[model samples]
Target: MASLQGKVISITGAASGIGLATARLAGERGARLALGDIQAEPLQKVVGELKAQGIDVIGTVLNITSNEDVDNWIAATIKHFGRLDGAANIAGVTTKEAKYPHLAEVSNEEWEFVMSINTTGMFYLLRAQLRLMLPGASIVNASSGTGLFGRPGMAPYSASKHAVIGLTKTAAKEYGPKGIRVNAIAPGPIKTPMLARVYGETKEESKPNEESKPKEDLKPMSTIPLARFGESPEVATLVAFLLSDDSSYITGTTRATVTGLLGPPRFWQPASSRKSTYGYLPAGQELEGEAGSPRLGLTPAQKLAAAEARRLSQAQKRAQGQLHRAGIEAQKQERLRKKRVA
Candidate 1:
């Protein structure tokens, strides 16, 4: 475990889910916490519990969608802690618009609602943290697996998450020189209240008597090799690692907790049948050559074609490298000629 001893870390959405798990873990690891959440009661309850456990902690109720609220929370954190060491931007939302509706059918209201909190609000919080943080400070933003790949009916959420990655990478490059690290995590199907609501699994629906009854199909689990949902603490561990000095060299990257589901299920193949050279074939397509096979399922001729394609790609890269070297030589010669004339 990475030591966060004496580090002052601020966490958004700390009232529940991964943020709550991270706060508990970070506190146990000796970090002083400034937790922010939209839920005032839950946030205070968590803070009081942590305080009882002898964890130095404070809670702020603020709306992430408001720049003023975000700024005030950061200000409060700095005032209490004296200096900010790290921050976790864990606040985000998803709507029923992500239930696989056609892109054209998605309501403008839903789109704006998701973007306001996930993207614009992230911009506000990240901007505030960047302004306050000094060298060696770290920031982790929450993204989702949907961010990396386009999912049906998830236009707004996907677009926002992709933007998060773009922001993380851009900030990493800009702030790397100053020794501030920025990164994002793309999680898949974590068992949080948000996900429970998405699956229509409310507390009433989760009673012991209802446990014997069949529930709605969990489509996301079909794609995951792990065959189960991830726990909040599992993600919290990664967040803690990123915030600590343990991941000092890691920045400008999005670590995925997707349980091996890289993309859509259609793009995946079983591990046993997977071939390095063959690459990914569509689901339900066998690799063996056969008549009337799926388009993605390669035959001998297609395999040969793929090999030829690789050969051509390698040749093109080599030619591009040679041209690049020649261009550098030309620039050097031009500089030498200019020096001689001078």
Candidate 2:
């Protein structure tokens, strides 16, 4: 692991989710932080928490969409910390409306809003940070799984994320000679407030009765091979790795933090439920003496082993699903308690 002691780092969207997770871990690693977010109260709270722990931190209220705000935040960082070693631009937004309409129905306002924050705002942020960063600095930007592959009903968001990757690559090349590194992270369906909003669920209605609800109803989560959503700390670790000297040779690439979810949600059936063998000749049937023959049988032992493997895999998957539901319940209770306090 790269040593973060005494290093000064800047982070946007530091009030919550992956950004907040990164800030917390970075602080624990001994880095001084310059945190910025539009949510002033939450940002200040985080700053106070870190300061109470003896971590050096400064917080600012910033709207990434404004060039001036971007510049000011960077200036504030340098003014407070005296230098910048790394930065994570983890702030971005999606549409408020769920079930995004077709491309033809996407409004001009929606397209511009997403582009302004996700792309143009990133440009501003990167430029400002790079202007003050010394050689050997690193920066990580937020991208999405949608950036790598297209999905229906999310043309604007997808396009904006694709543009983010482009910016990351171009910046890496432009600054490589200066010893600065740039990279992007593409995460799929993280369990964040943003995701809850995307699913049209508030804290009160977020957790469902797993026993009563069919597993298929989980939609995207069911499609992931892990059968669970990723936690914020998972992405935080990736961002920290990219920002640290541990990843000195890495740059100009988009790293995915999804839980083995390659693309769109597709209907998945377990091995026993699937009708086709998918060309897996059952474990150990001997081929006929004929040169070009196919045998469709399995030895008793082979069948037993195969069945054992499938059973173990299914059992592991079920355990993971149960653990994920438990986590969701914990998150729900915390949210509700916070609401009550407010």
Pairs clashing in candidate 1?
none
Regions more than 4 Å wrong, model 2: 203-218, 259-342
Candidate 1 lDDT score at position 80: 91
The CA lDDT at 10 in model 1 is 95
lDDT of 1 by residue, 132-234 (tens): 9999999999998878875544678889999999999999999999999999999988999887755556655432122211133223444565767899999
* TM-scores vs. true structure, each candidate: 0.75, 0.73
Q: Tens digits of per-residue lDDT for model 2 on 1-342? A: 656778899999899888999999899988999999999999999999999999999999999999999998899889888999999999888653443555787889889888898899899999998899999999999998878875555678889999999999999999999999999999977888877655556554543233222122234543344556889988998998898999999999999975334331111223342221111122233222122225333444445656989999999999999999999999999999999999
The model with the greatest TM-score is: 1
The clash count of every prediction, one per candidate, is: 0, 0
Model 1 compared with the native: what TM-score?
A: 0.75
Estimate the overall C-alpha local distance difference test score of candidate 2.
0.78
In the predicted model 2, the residue pairs found to clash are none
